[model samples]
Target: MLRTSLTFILLTIIFSSQKPKKNGVKDLFKESFYIGVAVNGQQVSGKEAGALPLIEEHFNSLSPENGLKWSLVHPKPEVYSFDFGDAYVALGEKMDAFTIGHCLVWHQQVPNWVFENESGEPLDKDKLLARMEDHIQTVAGRYKGKIDGWDVVNEVFNEDGTFRESKWYQIAGKDFIKNAFRKAYEVDPAAELYYNDYNVWKASKRAGILKLAKEMKAEGIRVDAIGMQGHYTLGGPSLDEIEKGIIEIAEAGFKVVITELDVDVLPRPNNSEGADLNINFANSPEYNPFVNGISPEAEAKLAQRYADLFQLFQKHKDKITRVTLWGLHDGKSWLNNFPVRGRTNYPLLFDRDLKLKEDVFAKLKVVSKQ
Candidate 1:
């Protein structure tokens, strides 16, 4: 009886000490993932400190890619404010977590005035292309060694798996993305460069990316990785597609990542009054249970979704460079105001009550066992 009790005690101590992954950075590149979150003003406050402890529990990285966009870092020309971004990076460093700069060039966030001439008319091809180059050089150059990687570009594809028309494409033609890569490399050669997009597992978008990658390589441009923006609904990509996609990306000379991941649980049956209250969640063919709020049953589904993904992640650990969540918790998520407004959505690995959801906790525990 004494022997049994002592054995149990020893096991508990060993498990407690090694609750987090044993190797922090060593095995990171090999069969490891970088869980992370996006933060806003509320998260930075003292009042919310206790609410964010789960961060230390799961994440090993920080991505304020949105917080450091053109609007915040340098709201105007010539002046720069690293206060917010620096704080986030400092947190990452303190936590021994990896840090990533979101993007150097994007079509949406730039002030409208950037595209206009003195008379307020939009710039022509030559001028717009020049502007794009300057934007890339300035942002990428500033963060040089500090950032491990840059998104380079984001959401360049449409829902039906098509590239949207943008000023970059209009002015520099196809060379805009290529030049963005070239200039980012020029400033910070060591930083990993990624081609990030949504719905990347689909046939049309992935095929276009293949063509784009070939074009870039032919022009001597190197794409270091592919960011599969995993902002998915209840039924994300099937297990087979994920396996095949990861293998294919690595085969194409790029690393794979589950970027911008979140499993949104929005109820169905279309509350016509709440029609627009949503995030990136689509309203059509509504889910059967109407995931208005994550019930105990809904939590089970959410947990299973993460577990299944993590299991597949284990399978492709060789090629997957990192796996990131879109935000820290449900409360601060942009999902609250995005595609749908006034609706409460539970799309994170944790619940709103700040308690560990069993499924998510179980998934991490599974990761630890390996």
Candidate 2:
């Protein structure tokens, strides 16, 4: 008995003396905010083995990239498909990760039948409100306790901060945004409801978002956080702008989520933003400069960009609740095909082969230590 006790104590001391391995981003920011990744159907279905381990190690929250959207999950009015969404929610549950439903209301990816009557004419306000309520209630109710949060509305405001005159707004005005949140909250009071948008760092857009957040609060809607889709580029939208936006949102009494974050390292067209999926010019050598690969210097700049943003995130960790990478690996990032088609864009922390860019994590670890 005495020999056994002495051997166990010796082993424990040796193990405790060894430095712990830094597994992934989750380990680095475990105490601060949830590190998250947007997942596709393949990752949710147990395929993409290479990316799965990295996701499990690095991220504590999962957002379905397209699984929960209206067109994909619910094509017809009375019919709903939950196959991919169910698998996604199940994966998050099994991993004990926070599951985020991508969106409940959006101007895009919605079926034509949503805003049209049987004769293809636009529906009136009453009809549109009913449809919106039904969709939110059914979907939010399905995964009520399982899903941690929902992006109740997405990208409804234009770059100039005016409400995008979409079918929703044309019919219901800003009440669409209000009713989406109210319905989602009514169905699942426990779930965190968010209004998510891209390019929210712009001064005009920031004002519009703060107005929406304030309106939600004033109206007693359960608006928990604002998802600033941080699809940034390497040199523009300076770090100061990013920090200022986060602080402003938090000061307005809402948690901030750095959602859909990726730093595009490629050259852009004259009027193109990094995440503008609609700007498709014919393929050209000038647009696709880095077809072969990103240069070493360019790679260094990307790493530094991530480090700078993360340092800001860590500094305001209290007001921030999550930081979600738009995608897991460079090979799968939508930036490759957006604004220009078939260009090799290295925008994620993981390489095309699903290997961690060591320097990126190294920079973050340095920040964490400081």
Candidate 3:
């Protein structure tokens, strides 16, 4: 454990922007990456308006991937709920941050009651497509020019590069993805529409989606960007693999976003065999997930891992436009209850106390290039 930490820190000294250099990573974000967050509107620590301060501090954008979904937007059918979206947009405007409306269609967040038939089955192709059109138009129309982009479709791909089995796919057929973008464009042709998903960096997976995008363009539909949901686990993929994927996606002529970024530390990783709850993702979201705890040595190497990735972002700034962290701090992070059930995962830029974790601050300094 000590050896790994030492190696990472040593690399940070060499790769970090802490070195006295002009035109470093920080300078780069001034134009691109408009650092942002995936935030929720839940009450937090006596401050019901959560994560707003962090947004003001570091981000130039805010994306409510789940908050802006169908259910959240319209909890009761036909009674639109602008309370949550309003608060987020107001904060973004006040902070001079770009607000991104995360999705128009998602299989998970929408209530099953709306999309089903009278018999409790889903609607037919025609009805399904019309319902989708109505929903997208209403939501995107309400926000219209204010939103920077929309992940019109989210996570449409299975991990092994297969199209997900969704109701949109079932009723509207393969045209569901294209139609979602079309509806978004129809509501606000000006607002950017994108296909957002995870694990897209893999060669075969990226290729499959790129081919679909090409076909969509051929059919006169516009897919303005591609969002890479960067929910990374320990040993998920190599740095080289991740870097290459970013370059290729940009090369395919779609804007790329690191939409939902996280690095999980769970099941103790079994190597160092630290105490079950010793390493708190809440304290440091970017702790080397593969490693067990935070040390001067681990801190250094984790810094480098962040630095190296930021370097990639720097290299492809022309192609990549935004790199939004999953959350502002560990306090309100969904990682706390996701995938592990009763496990707290820290995989973000700030700790629960709101101070920058060594890894997060170091990475920000790298991205800031100061």
Candidate 4:
């Protein structure tokens, strides 16, 4: 009996001494890539006090959710707001996290006055280009040396790989894209520049992006990475397509960053895809069946989906630099209102109470080991 007890104690000691399991997402993937999260103004400013501890523990990189957007930051031609932006940068510094500037040019959320003349007509090419340069220089320049990278342009290409006929395109054509990158580089040459977009898993859209990246490279513009927005659903965009997109982008000699990743588990209204802010559907019971909370079966599916994605990310860790989730927790997910309004969406690694989804997190932890 004494011998048996001694053996059990020895086994317990051996197991306990082996090594504490890595629980933090950043720690699990420390050797793979930077794990990141986007923060809103409240989170950065201590208004969302619960989030700061979670952010510091699990994420090694930071991206401002809406504070850095042109509409919010600049608002009008003569006015510029930096309170939230300053707080955001300060939070990154305090956490020693890799800081990212969201974007310099995007069609959505930009003020109409940016494209209009004093008479409220469209500005010509030269005037528009000047306006673009001024905005880029002012914004990018303010955060110069502080921000590690900048999404110089975003979602400029359609799914067919054609340039979106946004006001930027309509006024200045492709020069707006090139000039945006150029001005950002001029302001902060040390910062890595990126072109960010969604639905890049589509072959045509991926091709268009690669073509543009190559064109910019050939023309001596500095583009350090391509930000593939991984706003996925549990149902579509086969893993093969996502893997192919990552391989192709890396093979083309650019770092691939999985930006704004979230897996929506809710039913879609019209089977919509991608992260287009304009895509909105009226809320209904059928579309939001999980008002009380996600079903156990659906939650299991979400865990597996996140596990598979992390496995893929781990497999290609050498090619990917950063993987940033769009928001810190489900309660704050833009998915809650996006595509369908007033519907509760469980689309992040954390639950509504700011607790990590243990099942999903465990699966992801196992993926890191694999």
Assess every candidate by TM-score. 0.82, 0.93, 0.81, 0.94
Better of 2 and 3 by lDDT: 2
Write model 2 residue lDDT over 237-323, tens digit each, in one string: 888888888989989999999889998898788857635456687678887778888889998999999999999899999999999
Clashes of each: 11, 0, 12, 0
Pairs in clash, predicted candidate 4: none
Best-matching candidate per TM-score: 4
Q: Distance (Å) between predicted and true CA of 227, model 2?
A: 0.7
Q: Which stretches of candidate 4 lie over 4 Å from their true place?
A: 1-22
Per-residue lDDT over 73-135 for candidate 1, one digit per residue giving the tens place of the 0 to 100 score: 667656667777766666766767777778667777767666778898978877776776787
Worst ten in a row by lDDT for model 3: 269-278
- On residues 1-370, what C-alpha lDDT tens digit does candidate 4 reach at each position? 9999999999999998899744678998999999999999889988986889899989999998888899999999989999988998998999899999997899998999999999999999999999989999889989988999999999999999999999999989999999999889899999999999999999999999999999999999999999999999998778999999999999999999999999999999778899898899889998999999999999999999999999999999999999999999999999999899989999999999999999998898789888
Q: Assess the local accuracy of residue 136 in candidate 4 as a C-alpha lDDT between 0 and 100.
A: 91
Cα error of candidate 2 at position 178, Å? 0.4
Candidate 1 has an lDDT of 0.69
Candidate 2 residue runs with Cα over 4 Å from true position: 1-21
- Candidate 4 C-alpha error for residue 62, in Å: 0.5
lDDT (Cα atoms) of all candidates against the true structure: 0.69, 0.89, 0.69, 0.93
Per-residue lDDT for 148-233 in model 3, tens only? Answer: 78888876765566777777676776687888888888889887788887777777778778888878988999998788777665
**Residue 214, candidate 2: alpha-carbon lDDT:** 98
Q: lDDT ranking from best to worst?
A: 4, 2, 3, 1
